[model samples]
Target: MDIRNRLKTTRRNLLGLAAGAAALAIVPFAAQAEDGVLKGKNLAYIAFGLQYEYQVTLVNRVKELAAEKGMSISVYDGKGDPSTQTTQLLDVVSKQPDIILLNPVDAKLLQGGVRKANESGIPLFMLENLPPEGEWVAYNTFDDVAGGAAGADAIAKLIGGKGLVLEVRGAIGSGQSEKRYKGFHDQVAAKYPDIKVETLKAEWTADNAHTLVLDAFTRDPNVAGIWAHNDEMIRGVVSALRQINRLKLAGEEGHVPTVGFDGTPLGLERIREGTQDADVGQNPFSMAESIVGEMENHFAGKPVAKETLIQPVMIWKENVDSPDNWGNRVN
Candidate 1:
């Protein structure tokens, strides 16, 4: 088989093994699971910002799961402020945690901070986003570019390759936003010339997305589709559509076909309810586990890959009920 097929088969096999192992170990670990929490190890999670509600879920999931690995997690939120994030990095450097898991707010702004951490000999894990600068010990995130491309391609095909699209992007300068924008732009520009694309920046929060989407809809009532970089933005786009009475414009056959990333609980529900067309499902809970696993390896003096790009799956109404669908979501 070709490399792409080989990689697909390998990923499928790994998931199957992980599931089988979990099923078998559950009963035996019921008691020990509580006692196996990570202890006596300190790790720092440096974030680009923590304005999204999803961050709470990610934080809780990681803390609950990482505890079993005997590690304590501390969070330094940048509050969507890159300068503050930089300061937070300096603070983390002084404290010198065994490892740092970062979700950078601004990819470029965090370059210096990440470099400093690496220079201090502390292992750094960039989670769900990348720095604008040098490489790190390990980088864990969904394939946002692919997610964006898939989302846009779906919309283009749905609209018969002709329509105006408004894309609500995430925080400016963040890797997620950049990659997703490029993916959407690249795919549509290359394959669907009839599709017109307009981009707008959002704070990566639902409220901001709602506001921007609403205004865009009012400005351009003929917009045939919408795409958001993340779930929150998708939700915002949907909400704005509902408010402006445009949600009904693209129903079933002719609906505007909205798409998003992260496949959060809200995004999944949107698909089930038939309001959203599709979403790229990413396993953040698994990502959290992987982060701790890498941290453990770091503590044990093992080499970690410089970059780890997790695959993203597309979810649609047809396959929303499938077992595979649940594997990509957190809860």
Candidate 2:
């Protein structure tokens, strides 16, 4: 058999063996059991980085929910390194936790680890990221395309639909990054003929974004606006703009009306301070809640979605402090 068919057959066989060994716990809905509280189960949460405020926020929500539901969890930090993440995934698989939650640093590096988890019958969940080319119980997150499109629209509106806009994107191969960029770029090109969008890769970190921002400012000093794929990179952009003495508020005459995604607390705070124009908000709490809920339901023989797409929210300076925003809940 060819590779695709071989993978399918191997997965099927592995799942069959897993189902026989762990029963409905692996097959999901194969047993006639009622749903109950998630207790005594071990969950592993692996994030790309915790240093970033949003990721720390995401991990905190997961920890809180898992604790409330009576499940014990271990959090592993990838530290923005794919090799480190690969090692962490291997360690998680070795532990064979009841459930695994992964926000991968690199999809390719995690395929083997995902396969190992599948073969061992441990349910795996992906949060705030697309599933790798392997097995996953489900992927729970917002529509990055919507977020990007909304941000682009906001940017177009802010800049009068015509100007040179720089795009600060996440890691080179990030699924979310690619989707966000495409959606934003497509909308800008389609609806705003006069607007020009340029891009740079930041690897979802502030440091890379900071360096790129400096270079971009030197070459494109009159850049009408800038859009970062996430709030983390926005912070870097803001810092760089401030260093060059070019930062301005949305209404200010010299302002560039920078736009950001993620609506993180820092981003929202910047918006209020006029360092940023607007942001698209996503719920990390909802992402974590879905992961826990789905895992519990699947184990209880209850129905659950294979994929859940949460809607995105657009946040302007006026609503930065609204209770509905994830930033408001941040400590």
Candidate 3:
């Protein structure tokens, strides 16, 4: 071929390559534009209750991230009542916000509200607890069942796999509470057959837990360890033990090894103080990140997962101070 023809062919190939590179660079910017569409959108978060530390932290983190994205959020507390949550859900559905985040106080009772949201075609995201029937954009929550099993294992190991252990349960009919109860019992029966667990319903309140634990101890002072559904209940358990003169530090005589779920700052503090032995840690911060990210993905026309379960971590005094723990990150 002639030299002129060869030069022309090389120039055309270079131009094509340059054009391809430029197009590749613009792709990310285009995606950024899509992601930024969340700005000015409205979100309604219906929390189970704000009284508990874990729920408070989760809701606060969601609000913080939503604010950073320039989104407006309205929060409603269910106050641990199914009726209240149902009312709030219906009201929020009527308003038809861009997105609805629901942490149901009772999943069964909220089915009607969920169905209404579905019929209304509003995007609904579930947190912690999922309604029995609903079409959700995504459900982001911790593995409470696994967390319960971890607590079982901790308590069993502490008591040498054979002893009486008291279980401070959350509210009856709560999905998370039921799962934790089932997980704890299933694990104990399957893996630690010698352990005996007596349950007391506390309704996820500190006062109830304190009273129940105190009464249980009075009836059977031979209890070796205790497992509570949440850190808040553990707080009551600690107070009860202290009142009964049974609150002993780890490695001390007569010390009742206590295990709890929810990696709240208070739980981590108790672990450091040696009163609480172990905690099944759930990363609410990560849950918040997932919630916000899923919202963005939905707005950006991306596919959202049906469910995302954040794994639970077992935290002991040995690793309670790790900054990776959400409890440690909270100010």
User: For each candidate, C-alpha RMSD in Å?
Assistant: 9.7, 12.8, 17.3
Q: In candidate 2, what are the lDDT values of residues 224-255, reduced to their tens digit?
A: 88899988788678778878988777678798
Whole-model Cα lDDT of every candidate shown, in order: 0.70, 0.77, 0.83
Cα distance off (Å), candidate 3, residue 49: 0.7
Off by over 4 Å in 1: 1-39, 132-135, 249-254, 323-331
lDDT of 3 by residue, 174-277 (tens): 98899899889989999998899999999998899999999999899999899999987887898898899998888898899899999877788778778789
lDDT tens digits, residue span 1-331, model 1: 5433543453454345334333321222211234332456566776544444345445555666655765666776667788988888888889988767788777678788888888898877788777667657777777888888887888886677898988888877777778888888999989999999888788687788889888887788888888888876776776787787666533555466888777655566667666788877776666676777766666667776566777778888788766655333443
Give the worst 10-residue stretch by lDDT in candidate 3: 25-34
Instruction: Report the poorest 10 consecutive residues by lDDT, candidate 2.
Output: 24-33
Can you tell me which runs of candidate 2 are displaced by over 4 Å? 1-37
> What's the ranking of the predictions by lDDT, best on top?
3, 2, 1
Q: Which stretches of candidate 3 lie over 4 Å from their true place?
A: 1-35
